[model samples]
Target: MRNGNRRGKPVEKARHFWPTTKRLISYLRPWKWGVLLSILMAIVSVALNIVSPKILGQATTDIYDGILKGVQQMKLGLHITKYPIDFNHVGQICLIVVALYILSGLFSFGQQVLMTWISQKVVYNLRQDFKEKMGRLPIKYYDQHSNGDLMSRMVNDMDNISGTLQ
Candidate 1:
């Protein structure tokens, strides 16, 4: 029985990757708008995250430049008339960077929620289809295959697919 089970195991390799992917993507047709919006949110979130670091770098550069200017004035024996560092400008930059990060986080959260909702819907539809198909199979088919294996495929495999989609 063990040797027979080993021989009956499903193949691991995909015979047609692109076609399979296209077929899988077909399931997302009903939620196409949600998918598109989720993708856009992901793009915007990544862009904001990428830009925040450069904005921070600007604040660092400004501080370094101000310190160098102050040191040069001291070397020349000039009286200090004002503070070298521009605190207001640095503060504004900090605020902008913080805002960008917040926006990025919000977008990321929204994308995650949208994706979870979409994946659940897809899985729900798939389960319905599976149930309907199983009902249509002949009695002889049930007699040929192990009932435990069929149940595992119907339940456990679906759960695995749901996790992958998410």
Candidate 2:
């Protein structure tokens, strides 16, 4: 007699998603240093983003003050050293701003690199371990769960956990 199942391949049984999640969480246990590095990088990048604008604004205010004072000093034939408007001083201030911008950009890039490395590593390890576990799992485990359900638990659920880390 021919196989007469309506679904053709076979219907998958229900899987335990929670156990898979717990297993994946365990994979992250050994990567505390990478995780911490990622966090630190992110924090520094955010702080630089907040601080850069303030520094630039200060530079602008200082230049304006220098210019106003320079004008007053020039009218009295006094040395411009005491004045705020000196071109050299403005140049120095501009240099500082440029330095700050470069530093902030570097920090932001570092955060991205560290986070990507840490996240990818953690995700890779979790997937590998999960795959191994699935292989070793008994046929009876599959008896209660559908293939689609298991796949979703491995892919979608793992992604959800990684997203939480981010």
The C-alpha TM-scores of every prediction are 0.85, 0.64
Worst 10 residues of 2 by lDDT: 1-10
How far does residue 97 in candidate 1 sit from its true spot (Å)? Answer: 0.5
- Indicate the worst ten consecutive residues by lDDT in candidate 1: 1-10
Predicted model with the maximum TM-score: 1
Clashing pairs in 2: 12-146, 13-145, 13-146, 14-145, 66-84, 66-85, 67-85
> Candidate 2, residues 1-166: lDDT per residue as tens digits?
1443565755555488689668656776687777677678677767777876777777678778877878878887887656555567667767877777777778778867766666677888878878999999999989999988889877986687667665
User: lDDT of candidate 1?
Assistant: 0.88
> How does candidate 1 fare on TM-score?
0.85
lDDT of 1 by residue, 1-166 (tens): 4434567875566579799679668888999999999999999999999999999999999899998898899889987876499888999999999999999999999999998899899888888888899899999999999988998877886787677766
